[model samples]
Target: MSMRVAVVTGAARGIGLAVAQRLASVGMKVVMADLRDAAQAASMVNRDLCAGVDADVSDEASVQQLVAGVVARYGRLDVLVNNAGISPKHGGRKARVEDTALPEWQSVLDINLTGTFLMCRAALPHMRAAGWGRIVNLSSQAGRSRSAVTGAHYAASKAGILGFSRILAEEVGGDGITVNCVAPGRIATAMAAAVPETVNQEIAARIPLARLGTAAEVADAVSFLVSEQAAYLTGVTLDVNGGYFMA
Candidate 1:
């Protein structure tokens, strides 16, 4: 089989970087997209199969450029991972809805929800033309249930993803394109590190696995979802939460 091409957003570090590396390991040419420069991260991966490109998923022009660059170099797009998001923190805690600023809420929705929509819209044409594609949207456990740690905006954006993905799956199923989501819970990333150590420990204690999940673990789940083995799967949300929030 010809090597497939994948684009991973928010890949400068943490879960996104881990996903990029995992895809590359499986022989897919990977494009690591982020707001910040990801050359260093991409270099650490197999250079021949990976390249870093700067992009802000919330911006249409930037997303277009990012995908164009990938196509210009790789000639095709087989997978897209929408992982860029923002969960604003104030002194190690999410702001209460009563105190949350409009700008903060809009910004989260833009990047977390709107960004995912833009990426899928931009990539779907390519995928449809090719007649095969895989899209994985990153959601959170907070989206499925009331969140104790995250704010309303964050939870709302994630919940929106589930609805958006299901509808898209229905629309694209006949085109050989699959749209799925992954809801992660308290994964150990830079974003998650903002939580107080005491809180982290408490969350871990409640999880059936008795620990915060690792980025690589989440990446493995993504790898499976994008693989041929998951060809029959679509419109599903696989939880990588270590049993913290079981559906």
Candidate 2:
């Protein structure tokens, strides 16, 4: 069989980088896509097993170009890891809803929610053509409940992803494609750095694990979800929160 082609957005660093590395390590030809140029980050991994693309997931035209470039080179897409997102901070904590600006809210929604939809739309047709595909959307613990570390817009975007994944899973299961969401808690990454140190410490202390989860742990879950081992699972939210929240 030919090697699988996996596309992971926001893959220059953090959870996105970790997921790209994990998938590549497993023999998939991984494509690392990010708003920033990813040539350097992609070089850190096996250059032969990985490639990079500059993409702004929030823009429809950019997203289309991203998928087209990947298909033009690899001819097929088997897995999509939608990890591009932002959690904005003001004064080292989430901006209160009343204080949140309209632009901030829209930017978060554009990248976190609409971006996922666009990437899925662009990649799903290829997967359906091949008769198999895996889509893992990065959600958050905030989406499941309330979060002290992120803004309302961040939480709302993630919650929107949950709903979108479920509906898409229902629509595409017959085509041999699976859509799922990975809701991570306070994973130690640049994105999580937006939270105040005190807030992170306090939240960590409350968790049974008593520490922040690492990006690699979340990546491991994502790897499984996209692997053949998880072929039967769809429309489920996998929590990688280290006991911070349970459902």
Candidate with maximal lDDT: 2
In the order shown, what is each candidate's alpha-carbon RMSD?
0.8, 0.8
Candidate 2 lDDT, 1-247, residue by residue in tens: 9999999999999999999999999999999999886878899986999998889999999999999999999999999999999988877778999999999999999999999999999998999999999999999999998887789999999999999999999999999999999999988898777766787788889989999999999999999999989999999999999888899
Local distance difference test, each candidate:
0.93, 0.94
Instruction: Write one digit per residue (lDDT tens) for candidate 1, span 1-247.
Output: 7899999999989999999999999999999988887787898887898898888999999988888888888789999999999899999999999999999999999999999999999999899999999999999999998888999999999999999999999999999999999999999999998879898999999999999999999999899999999999999999998887878
TM-score of each: 0.98, 0.98
What pairs collide in candidate 2?
Answer: none
* Residue 121, candidate 2: alpha-carbon lDDT: 99
TM-score of 1: 0.98
